[model samples]
Target: MKVENLYSKSEENPMKALVFDKSGIENLKLKEIENPTLGPHDVLIRVEKSGVNPIDYFVVNYIPVKPMPHIPGAEIAGTVEKVGDHVKGINKGDKVIVYNRIFDGSCDLCLSGREMLCRNGGIMSVITNGGWSEYFAIPDKNVFKIPENMDWDLAASLPVAALTSYHAIKELEVSPNDIVVIFGASGNTGMFAVQLAKKFGAIVIAVSKKNWLKEFGADYVVGYNEVVEKVKEITEGKMANVVINSLGSSVWDKSLEVLGYNGKLALFGTLTGADVKINLSSIYSKHAKIIGTTGGSRRDLIELINLCRDCRVKVWKTYKLEEGAEALRQIMSENRDGRVMLQL
Candidate 1:
């Protein structure tokens, strides 16, 4: 593929990016800045779409970001604009998705294929600049070529939302005999968990207000108030064998209430709230296991891309790069339906 030198050696070029100077939505601005400088092991990408997640909202509104003026976006999808000499197997103009986890290859965690837990590394947007810009550079190993037919929005949602769900579901080891109940079924990660559990042959009970969840492979869709009763009726009082709760404290107790004996619960987010109380007797007596997971591995990402050829995230809305502030605000809106994204 033909490559374009966006950053010239003789003259520098600037690109537009959504950047925040401080921890507030009012501080976000779209300004022209010098293109990200590339290292020998890095590849420059012309971002096409960046997923707007709740974490992005928290980062801009509360979490401290590195280097004062920071770009905040973890899920990224774009075309390769330039590849450094040391970067192999990836060429310019290739469609790709960012891995979103920054890991040092030499770490013991990385060697064990658990890069998300690298002792010396953290998440992409938190430790360094992320993909809210028109042009950004990342290590060649941090990107994977997406299929030519994949939509930009779906590709962008994979790194965080989809990967987190995939990892959590994998940890639970859902099976055909298992009755899986997914809380926050309309949220980004919950939606993927519902589909994945069903894909694994489990009977999926999605807890959400949205009835359309059935279109995404949910065997039963019920409101938050109905989850426990619905699961009981469907399982003939056995309750759920696996309960995936990404809503945090708001549904923590209910999640446990619906679990059957030897049940496993997968946790990956704290959207409503984090602090919660647990009952020791309930856990020990029921033999319940609570598994907390985050991002998936590179191997898991590859598997996800293959398994999701026919699956897609329902995009709620799209905003321009300059409208990123509004996009972040929308992510936290109570009426929001699906994933929000910035389409560049």
Candidate 2:
């Protein structure tokens, strides 16, 4: 068990990893560890691409799910280098997308075919070793094979952003010709929501800091300050049938403000803050409903990947694995829109 700096590529099977020996990105260091031993139901993946997400930072800095010396990478797409004895339908050289949520296969919820509700399961990188390395092992049940023609980076980007948006869209019950307003529309999940909501036949109003969101198919793009007013104008006083808010606190009130009668407010993130003062009367008066979601189910992820494969969810940006820390920083400092990724 020797710890070494990550300066150059390793020529051995034991790989290099940026490990957080303690909570905080500053504690992250490059170290070498033994190659993973495969379990009967596992597949060894040669990591090709990993998605950078804000939740990764929250987990690394605050969550106690995993002990010190943890690795933080959730979304992944790669080639299968080896499959375990019990693994089937997945094999060497198969391109695949890793489902970042792990469910207890024996749970009643899991058995009911809704494993995303498995009481015992949690996120992939939160405790288990994740994809911020040259290689990692995943349960065969958590892996989905992708077509060879698919781009690895785009496939990696699908697990969280795309799937979560798909789930939120489902939660919002978006219908054809509906008016959908998405807060943080320039964000990773928000951008995906704009695309998916549109494809679902909604006229999407994206609330973003930038106007370029129109490039991604947002029917209308407005800044945070203008969201409520603009939605009113765009819908011609109809407001919105559904409002998607991943941004918390700063925009929560506004999300509620723009909802029409029987509207749905789907919350997926609390970036600004969580707790909010609510007017109970507003809910009853407008007949609006508030719903919340974390990541999405395996079905949502698989469908998202299929969408990516069809050139629906576009690739955003990529950084080398060595610049992993920088990649996280960029997600915090640079454009919050689109999928920011790492290439191994």
Candidate 3:
């Protein structure tokens, strides 16, 4: 296959992208915009596939307008078409996954190998234009090489959902005997969390609406009705050693309620609204730890890619770029079982 170098800008060039004119609106119109100019340390990518995440809609509809007509998307897989002057180790035509978090290497967090938590961290699609386009440019350090044999759609799905799961599972320090509870286990991120927890040797107890449990490979699946009791029963009144909550407030109390003493509750997302009331006694009494996680580092992304490359992990599905919005809609409506991708 002859890889196209779309990022090589001439005097006249244009790129197609989905853009939102304002917040609180669901409409995203396709527009022909100027190709992005690459910086000295940047690598330009011709996106082959972009993964749709829940945050894409949240920021489009909820976030305050930073600029008019924002393009919202984060995860993407593509071929590097151009490399800036200072870029090294990556060449044009390399298959790659773009990490959304951009940080200065000189920052304290970055210096300590915590680039995801750097004070100057910038998230693609949120702070800047993202991968909902034909081509995009990002720092070379943010692009992890994807194995040539790996499916582009799967590669696209890795940047956000999988990375976040990797980060959360790492934080939990899950062991083979630990009982891990995954809230919203059917969603893309949640499903990845479930699989990752299981991979780490934890016995997974996936929690979701009654109808979605079987699909998630949950040992004990429960619905909204008697959720806490069901979980308690599943654990024989012992509860989980680690609770991974990607749905946030919707399952906050239940997550906290189902943790064993000294259990860790890793909160990654707020898919179902953010606000929730929690009892302080429950946390303190059980010595439960509530840890908040965001994105992952370059090293984490590399590890995840290697895992997927080695067949240790599998992606659910792959879609073409034209199907981007539809993929997003299915994910947002909870109609999809696994990660949805947009192929270029």
Candidate with top TM-score is: 1
Per-residue C-alpha lDDT of model 2 across residues 134-206, encoded as one tens digit per residue? 8888778889988888877668778887788898898788999999999988777887888889888999898
Q: Candidate 3 residues 1-344, lDDT tens each? A: 00111244553778888877876435776777778777777888888877777877677777753445687777888899998889989999999888888677788999988888878756777767677888888877788898889876567778987889988898778899798888877776776777677667777877766454444445666665576787688778998899888887877878887899999999988877799987899999999898998888888888888765532223456655555566666667545555666666
Q: By TM-score, is 1 or 2 better? A: 1
User: Least accurate stretch of 10 residues (summed lDDT) in model 3?
Assistant: 1-10
Sorted on lDDT, best first, the list reads 1, 2, 3
Reference-based lDDT, each prediction: 0.87, 0.80, 0.76
Assess every candidate by TM-score: 0.96, 0.92, 0.88
The per-residue C-alpha lDDT of model 2 at residue 80 equals 95
Which prediction has the highest lDDT against the true structure?
A: 1
Candidate 3 Cα misplacement greater than 4 A, ranges: 1-11, 24-27, 65-67, 209-220, 224-226, 310-326
Order of candidates by TM-score, top first?
1, 2, 3
Give the C-alpha miss distance for residue 336 in model 3, angstroms.
3.7
Across residues 1-344, which tens digit of lDDT does each residue of candidate 1 receive? 11112233433567888888888999999988777667788888999999898878988998886756888888999999998889989999899999988888789999999999989888888877778989878888888998899988788888888889988888998888689999999998988888888889989899998988999999899888877888889999999999999989999999999999999998888988999998899999999999999898998999998887777788899999999999999999998999898998
TM-score, structure 2 vs. true: 0.92
